[model samples]
Target: MCGIVGYIGKNEIKEILLNGLKELEYRGYDSAGIAVLQDRELSTFKAVGKIINLENKLKDFSTQGFGIGIGHTRWATHGKPTEANAHPHIAEFSNVVHNGIIENYQEIKEMLQAKGHHFLSQTDTEVIVHLFEENLKNCDDSFKAFKKTIDTIKGAYAILLISKKDSTKIFYAKNGSPLIIARGEGGIYFASSDAPLIGLAQEVVYLEDGDIGFMQEGDFDKLQNIQPLNINKSFAQKDGYRYFMEKEIYEQHSVLLETMMGRVSEDRIALENLDRDFFEGIESITICACGTSYHSAMVGKYLLERFAKIRVNVVIASEFRYADFVIKENELFITISQSGETADTLEALKLVKKHHLKTLAICNVDNSSIVRESDRVILTRVGIEKGVASTKAFASQVLVLWMLGVFIAQEKKLINAQEIKEQAQAMLKATKATKVDSKLHERIKRLSKRYLHGHGFFFIGRDVFFPLALEGALKLKEISYLHAEGYASGEMKHGPIALADSHLFTIALMPEHLLFEKIKSNIEELSARDATICVISSQECEVADDMIFIPKASSYMEEFFSMMVALQILALEIAIKLGNDVDMPRNLAKSVTVE
Candidate 1:
């Protein structure tokens, strides 16, 4: 995944492009570059790492009178993260910045070479600009030539193109990847997501598959060039938080409310988008997802079986697509993704479609590929999750799964309306009660400092909390660059406990649930070996060398929400204490669009 931004405005082009790139840096940060049109020539500058490097490089260049530019921050796929492979690839006739993989680049490169076209870098993106240059030979219109270039390529892509001959306009298109165009006070802007458009654009247009459009310098009022989109201005501000992650963490309460808004009442749950008859004859369900979404599915398995009395299987999307797995009759396939364009999950969805099984999608983005392809869809109203490490999105996914369990329970007559309403109210209370104060963060920071130089880490939880343990470990390792492993509390003694000692730190999740004593015993075992134990629990206990206390939840569902928020805060504080980049981690991208 990479971040691409284009600006056509009256402001200083370099500053606008650089600021937009910085805002979109979470998508990718391996390399940064910008291409601007000035003096009827396309000038490019790129650096090997970070947007700051690109900014330093631009100090020697002149950007005066330049009002049109395209920028990119790259997460390398086809080539190494080198300056030569960075984006804003320029050719004789056009300059282009691309996101997504080019599956047929090799074949096209050979044909272009035969036609006497030479290549510079070992990037699939270079093939696109060169192809645009070749298409201009057969067509006079820049838009038609760009379309012709798109016709020859295959795979997911969102490309922004600017012709040297026509420096006043920027042409772009998207297929199977995200690309949004917005109209701002300054001018028209385009980016991979809405984060970069904040404070810059008042209205945004989300491009669908095969959608092609362009923006001229003063064409903010013209809606004839592209499909008009409804603007929701709520997402434009950070609401006074220092970082997006912190804002998102605190927004979980509202996220849960929005996810369940108008859909749950005193006695019933309403998934209005899903047909009433769709749940009929669904004997089993297979949920496929990646990363945070997969962890949510793991928790869903517990909820569905315990409350809904339905058998469930959770599979990693990448492995499920390649493995020789069987889909039995009357089985339902569901996929969960925040972006709804994750390559492995989307590929698995395509494969599931071939079997003619009923499919459902739990996605945050409306009209995403997964949402459009599924027979039934549940949209999580979490808004745009800008942080690379997901916080609010995961909480919303769990809330939706809880609603689904209650819905299925009501459908089977296993639970009454009063019981359902009580459950909903409990959840609402839990969301409001889960808060991370400055004092808690200070304590977590102290714990993080003490364990900062440890060799590795172990996160242990039992029952539904097991998936949370995995998710907690993932967050710590993702942002802090620490080596960590998560294991079921019971399974810790089987193998992982041997790795635990004074040199390794253990963070245990001890919720006040059915398995509380069992997990506490696991913590005790680790303590016996002189392991430093940091316990996240509803109450303080003797076994915990350090305790991070959460509000005692009334139900296991509430406990799940509270414990999740606690662990997220722990991870964030740990990363911040270590001086790591919490928003954009090394060697990772926000959306994994390429396999």
Candidate 2:
């Protein structure tokens, strides 16, 4: 998961490249660099951590040229986050910025070293520029040399190559990694994702695997009718909020509407991309995803099994990649990813595609890798989630999955019209119920500090709420850098309750409509041991040390939507109390585009 941005135009290159990289900073921020070609000379600047460091290095640097440049923000796959290992790796002939793994780099490095070539850094990416440099000796054209270098490499990569020999063009190639070319105001721009291209470019092309091409100085303006990227510049701003995470956390109300607009209604969930009979006779479903998406899949498993009356399996995409799945005769494969370019999930999608299974993707980005690879798709219109910790995307994913499950149940005649109508009304109510207001925010902010002193936090629930517990604990751990665990409330006495004490915080999700008493006794069990309990529920739990009561939801689905938003706010407040970067948490990128 690295950010790669390049430009070739008449505008000033540094600011354009830097701004594009800033949009893609959620992809990575371990280290960053840029290689800008000016007046027939290539200049390279490197920084050890964060794009800001690179920006500082280029503060006083001056340049005069046609504005051809390539920049990188690294998530460091092959080497440590060091200046020596940063991207825009330069050799004698060509400089390169690459994403994805070079699986056969050691062997290739040895081959190149034997030919009297020397290496500079402990990175697999260094091999690409050096290989291109070596290939230039055999080919008259730099683009041909770049192609030969790509042909020789055996791994995943979205590569941008430039050379001192040809400052008028920016050559690119993609294989098993994300790379898109956007025709914008000045010229053609390249970014690993749509985040950078949006607002900057109107038309864009998502380059496919095995695609190789170059944008020459005089050639990009001819074809002007390509599909325009759905650009919303507001997604990149925090408005008056302190951080994007906070803005997104409060955006759930409108986000629910955005996700349901045109696609979800009272009588139907319009996923017409899948054939009418697609869900017919589907004995089971396999949902593959990672991180927050994986947690959403867990919730989906509960919904799909409860509503659709089908066996549902939620597999972590990273593990699913290597596992030998038991694919059934009438099984459906669904994958979830906000970026749709998550490397493990995309690889898993490709892996299952080999078995000829019908695939559906629930994603936010329109043309992400997962969306392109799937047989059918559902777009979660939560807008661009700039926060690396993921606020609105998770809410939208879970909501979309719920709608899909209920729709399938109706389509299969598993639920009657009365039941379907009730489900739809409950969803409509959820859009209003799942709102977080100033009262709850203030309440959460007031108590957010009490949680910071805990040794660890336990987010406990039962049945479907078990996954919400996991997600709650994950959010706390991700943003606050605190130790937290999510466990079934029933399993407290099994062994974990021994760790419960005043120093321990338990954020119990005890919904009034769903197993409230069952989870209440579990909370009481933890209370007996003097665990600091922050109860988030619609019921008054006398055993809780603190409470953030939500509006009583009408149904199980509504309960989840409301409680889910509450948990997200709780985590955001807690992280803010600890003075953590709420938007970009440490060592965590927004999109896990690499394993």
Which runs of model 1 end up more than 4 angstroms from their true locations?
A: 9-11, 59-67, 138-144, 166-168, 184-187, 199-204, 212-242
RMSD of 1: 2.8
Model 1 agreement with the true structure over 1-595: per-residue lDDT tens digits: 6888898877788888898888777665699899988767788899998777898989877666546899998999988999889988887867899988899999999999999898888999999989988988888888888888898899989999988877798988888778888887777888887667777787777777888767786665665434445436566447897667878888888777888888877767888776447888999999999999999999999989988899999999999988999998899999999988798999899899999999999999876778877888999998877788988888888888888988888888889778888977876876675555667667766766777777898989988899989999998888889898889999977988888778888988888865888888999999999888988887787978888877777877777787788788878877888888887888988889888
Residue 44 of candidate 1: its Cα lDDT? 89
Q: CA lDDT, every prediction? A: 0.84, 0.86
- Return the lDDT, model 2, position 489: 93
lDDT of 2 by residue, 50-121 (tens): 778888999998656576899999877777899989988998866899988898899999999999988889
* Candidate 2 displacement at residue 345 in angstroms: 0.8
TM-score of each model, in listed order: 0.92, 0.97
Off by over 4 Å in 2: 221-225
Query: How many pairs collide in each candidate, listed in order?
Result: 0, 0
